[model samples]
Structures are given as C-alpha cells and as structure tokens.
Target: MSDFSATGYQPVSVSDPEVAALVGQDLPEDAFREIRDILFTVKGFDLDSYKDRCIKRRIAARIRQLGFPHISGYVACLAAEPTEQLALLEALTIHVSQFFRNPTTFMVLEKKILPALLRTRPAGRELRLWSAGCAMGEEPYSLALLCDELCNSPEQITIYATDISNDILKKARQGRYEPHRVAEVPDSVLKRYFTLEEGFYRLNDRLRKRVRFFHNDILNDRPFHRVDLILCRNMLIYFSPPQQEHILKTFAAALVAGGYLVLGRSETMISETRELFECVNAAERIYRKKADDVKEDD
Candidate 1:
C-alpha cells in the first residue's frame, strides 16, 4: 500500500533521473496517441498542453495501479473503468500546497518584494497579486493574512487565486480547513484571520473577501496581464522545459516592469528566458521583470 498518513498518498519521487528516463521510453507511437486522444475526445481532458514526460510517468503510475501492462492496455481499460481516466488526471495535477509553504520564500516576499511593490504604487492605487496553482486555498489565504499584516489597508490589495481543478476551486471558495493543513501557519495569523470551528479552522470572510478564486489552466488559458506580483511556486517542476519557457513568457507578459515573479524554491529561469526577468533574490526565487523596450511578440 502507498504511504497514507497526514500527507495522504506519498508519491514516489518523480524527479529521479532514472524514473524520468522511463517516461515515454518504450511506448508505441500509435498507443501514445490513442491514450492522448481518449483523454481529450472522450474524457474532455487535454494532454497536449502538458509535457510528454509528465503525462507518461503519471499515466504509468495509474497503469501500475490497475495492473495494466502498457499504454495499449491502459487505453482499453479506460473504456471499462471510466473512472480510471479521472484517477489518472488526479494523479497528474500534483497538489502539495500548504499554508506558508517555504517560510524563507514568504519572508523574502514580506520583507523585500511586497515592500518594494508598495513603495512604487501611487497612494490609493490597488496593489494586485495572483497566486497561480493555489491548491485548496491555503496559499492564497496565507497571502491574504500577510496582506492584512503588511498593507496599510488590506482592502486596497486585490488577489486572484486560480487552480486548474474545479473540484479544488469549490473547496477553496468555502475557505474551511483541517488542523494539519494549517500546522505551519503562525499563531498570530491564526488568531486574527481564522475562527476555529469544532476541530477545523474556518478562515474569516474578511480574509476571504480580499481574494477571488477561479479556475485557470496555465498552459492554454488566457493569462492575466498587467498589474503587479505573481507567485507561481512549485508548479514548473511538473512541466517540460518548453512548457516552462512558455509559462515564463506568459508571466513576463503579465507583470508590469519592476513587478516581481516568485517561483518555487526548486524552480528557476533557464538561459532561454534570462533577459525576460532580472533575478532579485536568487535564493528566494524572486525575480523582477526587466523593462521591455520592444513590444512582446504575439
């Protein structure tokens, strides 16, 4: 059985080089297309937007779960076990978010990035923020609490929190959470922004009111443009280099010059997009958008 503790199913390291190499290594071309087509046409799930390695390994995991021998078998099995396709998608999305994840990163945002952004904003001008890949609402709510503490008027700050899953977005809209999910939250933040209900902590509407939750697919969906800082932490690891580059371009296009881009601690900008953003705090994965002298290519 998989490790299912407080963390739920503990996935085996998908980052292992050897494991990564196994992705799409032996799959037949026709079979691969069959699986992708089934996911797209029948299941209404688009696999092309995601990297092949990500799709293949996650599909392989589901194949193991169902005792299927290969992609061909898995594709056939999907007809009989329709729910299996959903199981594959749930596996692929990879939600590991928690409140105040990576304390050092948030510390940098609070002390450096937010301060700089505030200083630049004209008085009464709204400071905008977007939390991409905001899973179950912990990250966005954490940002909300931080804004409450840092901003002179929390109402002046507007936050957009987006995730790809409608199921996940529904839970985010509720703003309710279990204790273990909030274990990393500070006592002060908890006392101020949350109301304890039974055993779980319910985030106050005051905090929730500041943020707008919605569903967005980072790859193909229309990216939010203009404004200020964007936090896309721990999300690029699931994408291919090309996908990562496309995402970086999207972020660059979205942020105003001098606006900040905060990525996951493990993620970084490649040489291909170095000119897009200047590194502000390398260790904290904070980058400031470099002024675009030329109009961005469509």
Candidate 2:
C-alpha cells in the first residue's frame, strides 16, 4: 500500500499477538464485510467502492483508537452508537485541504484556465464551476478568489462546492479557518479577502456568498450540469478503479463540450475515460472534455 503518512495515518503496532494479527491480516474477511455492510445500511456510505486495504487500515485505526480488542467489538460499537458511525465515516473519508494546496495547479487555473473560460463564455450564460469533494471549502474558495479577480462581474460566475460529509459542509459554510489553513494564501490576497479575528482567518461575506455548498456524494448523487470547470483534487485516490471510472464518466457528462476538469496531482484519467478528455497539462493533471464529434474508445 502507498504511504498514507501525508494524511496522518500511521501504521499501528501492538504487543498483543491476536490484535497484531488482526491488523496484520487486514481483519477477518467476515468482520470487514460486517463493518462495510453496517456503514452502507446506516449511513449510505458504500465502503465497497473504496480500496479494501485503505478502508481496512482506517477501520483498524479506529479500532485501536477506541481500545477495542478486535474487529467484532468495533462492529458492535458501530451498531449501537450513531455518533460512532459518523466518526467512522469521517475517518474513512479522510479530508486534508488548504488554500491553494497545490500551487502550480492554482497558478495554472488563475493564469490559463480561468482566462480561456471567460473568453469563450457565451453571452447571458453564467460561468459554472464545481469543486467536488470540497473539503472545508478551501478549493472552491480558492477558485472564487481567482474568479473574483478575472470576471467582469460577480454575477458572471457561479461556484458550487460539494462534499459527502455534512459536518464538513457545515464547517465550509462557516467560512472560517485557522492560520495554518490559510498559509498558502498570498499576503495581498489575504488582506483583501479575509479578516483575521480571534486568531482565526474568516473569509469575508462577499467571497463567502459566491460559493454554494451542498452535501453530495459524487458516487451516488447527481453531478452539476453545464459546468465550465470542475476541480476534484486529492479525493479520487481513495476509490476503486471501477468507481473512479464511474466518477470520470459522470464528470464527462456533467461538463459542457470543451469544458475543463482538474484532478489531483497524484490522480490521472484512467484508461477507460482517457478518450473522454484530452490532457491539457500533464504535470498539473488538467484535462479538457472532448467535443461531441470526437470518437470515444470502445
């Protein structure tokens, strides 16, 4: 498995051989299935779509955190506590975000993507952008800052940010962040867009009003339509190949012809969806949706 250290997930070691065996063996298959089924039944979270080992590690981490001896105990806890189910969902859906998390990608968006989209936008039509899996609103807020700079008028742009976690969405709506979260924000831009209050940098009302936050599951919910650009960064790496492909196809259908799609620095268009989009910036993982006349891979 790839190192999840970046997300603060550390491999746990225990002295108890049985507990160690549970972690080492990725938990018994039946126990893991029970956990998955419980999450699906209670929260509508489809654990089957996630990478198996990654989900296992998260579950094991939770088990270790709660001081559970084994997987069965954790399963019982999940069944009994509603809060624990939300906690497990939060654990499973790891969200690590900051303003302009990847500088180059944002630079590309500000300098190249936004300009091109503005020039090509049809008269009387709003420029629509979606930030899928927008954790705590940084990605979409970052886009809003750029759009605020480039667009002729505020009405020209419409930004929609969505995440599966309602709790995270509530935080996003609050539009407040700690100092570390806004570290990447440029000094001048920070002064203009945010107010430092009580040690928290709060995004100003004008910019806050620019974005619409929704509780959405990309796998199961309807995607935004007629979008000029979609930024789904760092979130796709959690899913299985088939789920990833399903999401890519959904993005393809969501975007208008010649629309742009920006993925994470680590993610790429899978083989099945490659023909749906032409690579625009390989280093930045930016792609453009192919026009309807273009032929798709069989």
Which candidate's TM-score is highest?
A: 2
Report the C-alpha displacement of residue 58, candidate 1, in angstroms: 6.0
lDDT of 1 by residue, 116-231 (tens): 88888987889889999998888888888888889878888889999877778898888888888899998987887789998889999888888899888787787776759999
Score candidate 2 by lDDT.
0.86
**Residues 16-39, candidate 2, lDDT per residue (tens digit)?**
654775667456667778988898
Report the number of the highest-lDDT candidate.
2
Weakest lDDT window of 10 consecutive positions for candidate 2:
1-10
Instruction: Name the 10 consecutive residues with the lowest summed lDDT in model 1.
Output: 17-26
The clash count for each model shown is 0, 0
